[model samples]
Target: EKEVNSMIGRNPDFARRVAIDFSDNLASAKMLIPIPDDFPIMAGEILRVNTGLDIHLDANRRPVVALVGVSLMGVPIPNAWLGNMK
Candidate 1:
């Protein structure tokens, strides 16, 4: 938890711009990905938006667990458009 908080503090822009949620079970969790109407949705965009949640568990007498989920709300493009170059 401390590591996650520290990461959020270090990257304020990422923390503010992304939509994040947490739940006890996968069935109960809901994620909303927003794509602008003006933006084009390519074939692979849906696959990119659908990310997985990682669950880490400890095997000690008293188990400890952590769940991390990241969802990208928009299609990501390269910093420079490939077609733009002559």
Candidate 2:
């Protein structure tokens, strides 16, 4: 974060904030964040995530697998898998 902070110092006014979002062909989830927009957009200004395979047990105790991945402009970003529980 230090690197970004340094960049932010360069532009103290024009830049406003940074944001990250997740989207699929059919839907999108967006999170707007307040950040030093002065931070230079890195060489690769895109982010993406890969969710290779998912395994889960259904109510009947059967395992299921699904092909999954995430992308910001088709590039993969890093992410952690979250489990769903009732």
Best-performing candidate as measured by TM-score: 1
Residue-level lDDT for 44 in candidate 1 = 28
**Colliding residue pairs in candidate 1:** none
* Candidate 2 clash pair list: 48-75, 48-76, 48-77, 49-76, 49-77
In model 1, what lDDT does residue 45 have?
35
Model 1 vs. true fold: TM: 0.28
Model 2 TM-score, 2 decimals? 0.24
The CA lDDT of each predicted structure is 0.41, 0.42
The sequence of per-residue lDDT tens digits that candidate 1 reaches over residues 20-73 is 344443311233334555666643232234233434345665544332333344
Candidate 2's C-alpha runs over 4 A off are 1-51, 70-86
Cα deviation in Å at residue 75, candidate 1?
18
Across 34-84, the per-residue lDDT of candidate 2 in tens digits comes to: 335465663334333323444467689887655354445455554453323
